[model samples]
Target: MSLTEDAIEKIIGKFGRYQTWILVLICVGRIPTEMQLSNVVFIIPSVNYVCLDEGAFNATNYCPCKYPEYDTSTIVSSVTSTWNLICDRNQLASLAQSMLQVGILAGSLFYGHVSDRYGRKIAVLLSLLSEVVFVAISAVVPEFWIFMVCRFLIGTAVGGTMLCCYVMIIEISGKSFRPYLPGLIELPYSISYASLAVIAYFLRDWRHLQLATSLPWLFVLFYYWLIPESPRWLITTGKRQQAIDLLTYIAKKNNRPTENIESLVIKIEEQSLKENEQRYGTYLDLFKTSKIRVYTLIMALVWMCCSHTFFGINQYIGRLQGNLYLNVILSALILIPGLILVVIGSLYLKRKLSVIISFSVAAISLLVFIIIPSNMENATLAFAFIGQLGAYTSFVQVYLYCSEIFPTMVRNSAMGFASVFARFGGFIAPFVVNIGIEWASITIFSALAFCAALLCLMLPETKDTVLLNTVAQTEKNKVVVNQEST
Candidate 1:
């Protein structure tokens, strides 16, 4: 174990009161992320429309309609209806979602650096503040172009917030607690996901639903005062006193004796210096060693596969045969069992095996969903649910697996770098789902899932392993694992 983990074990123990409190706060804050990402499904739903100008409509079936009447029994006013995004303007709806993914791509890379340099707390706060400001602005924007820009900005903040929160949770907890903690934190995400369906069902109008989701984030901003920076990050950057103070604070809150806290911090500081000869690691360092470079590439591909399939399935839910609200609710509810499977994987299975199993499940289920006849609505929906279950499991597990594989020095950078590919996958998902033939999209998703599972075979397992603090340790661990396999 690294000195920081030892200090946490000795001084704070695992699952302490302070840790539990912060975990709850962080989980609650995560609610908005899902809300923002999935909101597009409802906010720009497909609505039936008729062109007002009969001559132009008759002349060219694809002519732009200045005013189109929309059926509003189900959804009163959405981006589709408000902007007349029908016929020639239909592609704009998908463009709005794509812009959000582009923003996430930018934010993940930007905030990964910021979190590594400025500290996790500041990055998280900035992300929250940005989400609130832009999401609220998005609610009232008159023009579709302006709203698309806001969606982009909101995606950026969501990316940063998610990356920082994930890193902080792993850094603060002990190894024994690491696996289960992600599952717990994701609980609120699932609930928020389901609750959005309920909220949107009542609001009917896109603007009202937007406001309802954005308002709760105002309360989450108080996290600036409540959450603390990671002590491990402090020690790595040569902030010995701050690290000690935070550790002491954790000890007191957990009712652990702090009489030896100073000495423990001193030891941890010296060890950190010895382990990490370089004080700060950069993205370039990720490619310094061959093994690390290979791992980085494989992780990027895995993340891409996971993101593409997960978001693709989410956006495709509306097209499924059923009540849109019920389909979304069922999709969200299915994720709970997937999360439980992650917990089970953490306790009983190797990291590689868990990811492989998840990807295989997704690939097989999606393939089955594709082969089934379209007219069999009940069978198709059941299979779609199963596919989502697998996709979600792989998505969540990849976050945990990625964190464990990379060293602390470049963990956030690595995560951000990998997430760039993930977001890229997300960026294209809307187009794939909306433009492509339904079976083609499912086949593509299934193929990628199978490829991702195969790639996992090349990477080393990280279950029950100590989180390494430096690049040298990362390379060394890979070598050890390779020798053991041989």
Candidate 2:
């Protein structure tokens, strides 16, 4: 009877809490798909890139490399001056993407600290709002150098979006809804990504594409009304008053009543002092202890696996070596099944098995491409397309696992480390796909698949385990979250 009671409590526990699917949507909802497609123009030096020139990277963040100073005077003429440099022009565009990733890394890593210290509302709102500004600035950079800076800044903002939203959704939903919520986030993100391709198909010019993608950020201002502060964080941070108030708000929004809310909600069970220590927002902390170190390391590899194939397919059009339209359609095609598989898995399969199975399938699918050979009629193209379906499933699992494995306080930070790895893969994507595959596409896909398969071994099963409360809690049972209004 107690077992049944616990299960009931768990369901009740999840009511109105941040569900995983909603979190997934928030994370990927506004990805600048159009910007990436349009920005492809920047790779061609002869195109003569022109826009506002603002310094890239740490023109704001606490890093270095601020140079060339934001100057608009000769932006057009200066960029045109490099007409002869067209052969090597991809360096700048790739560099811009890399810089943007730096910001993403920063945002992902540090925003948790901010969210932990302040509130998720402030953290998420500030991050998205900043992206809005950066996106616009990226659209209007007067000089080539300034554009790169804005891109990096924009990356930083979007980086925070994924992790923060992940946490937010988990904190809001009921237990039964949590896993599904995480994958649900992918739907909107996929839509946004494909839309970029669709819009780029029409806009053509980088500036216009930039405008098309970045302007939507203005819509984020609506978050001020649509979103709420994370109730879990509020509860953990000793803001019971705010937590309760937020709960009331969610109940109201969901059409559920607060008349019996107190009885309906079961407070979480808080931890003891040593277990109570919050996450230290630093690089050392990621490697501070054994369990965290293991999770962090495995997550890095997982990031590599996810990013390698993810961006690999996205960056290399030649790999498809097929119809451009067909390649894109295939790329977009994977999202549907990907989301479907995630839903099916989360509802039916155990978490670990689902993840391993998905990863294994993707790896094998990738390997199949090598044996099938690109020369065969539609072999490589069809394989690449199918493999991406596996990649999408694997992708959602990473987010689900990461969110469940880290303490709520450091969720953003740990995800940040993972993001850095993923971003690094994203940064290297064009080069690996464009250059490496020139020699052999099969070899590239084969290596990536095998690596993913191997990395899946290091991660322990996070499903059904209590969600992590601290680095020390990884190998043991789930870290117990407090249920009371301390």
TM-score of each: 0.95, 0.79
lDDT of 2 by residue, 87-114 (tens): 3454564465456656776777777667
lDDT for each of the candidates? 0.83, 0.59
Model 1 local distance difference test score: 0.83
Q: Which clashing pairs does model 1 show?
A: none
Error of 2 at 353 (Å): 2.4
For each of the candidates, give the backbone clash count.
0, 39
Best candidate, lDDT-wise? 1
Per-residue lDDT value at 200 in model 2: 53
lDDT for residue 279 in candidate 2, whole number 0-100: 34
Candidate 2 ranges beyond 4 A from true positions: 1-85, 255-274, 277-285, 322-326, 373-377, 436-442, 465-475, 478-486
Name the candidate that leads on TM-score.
1
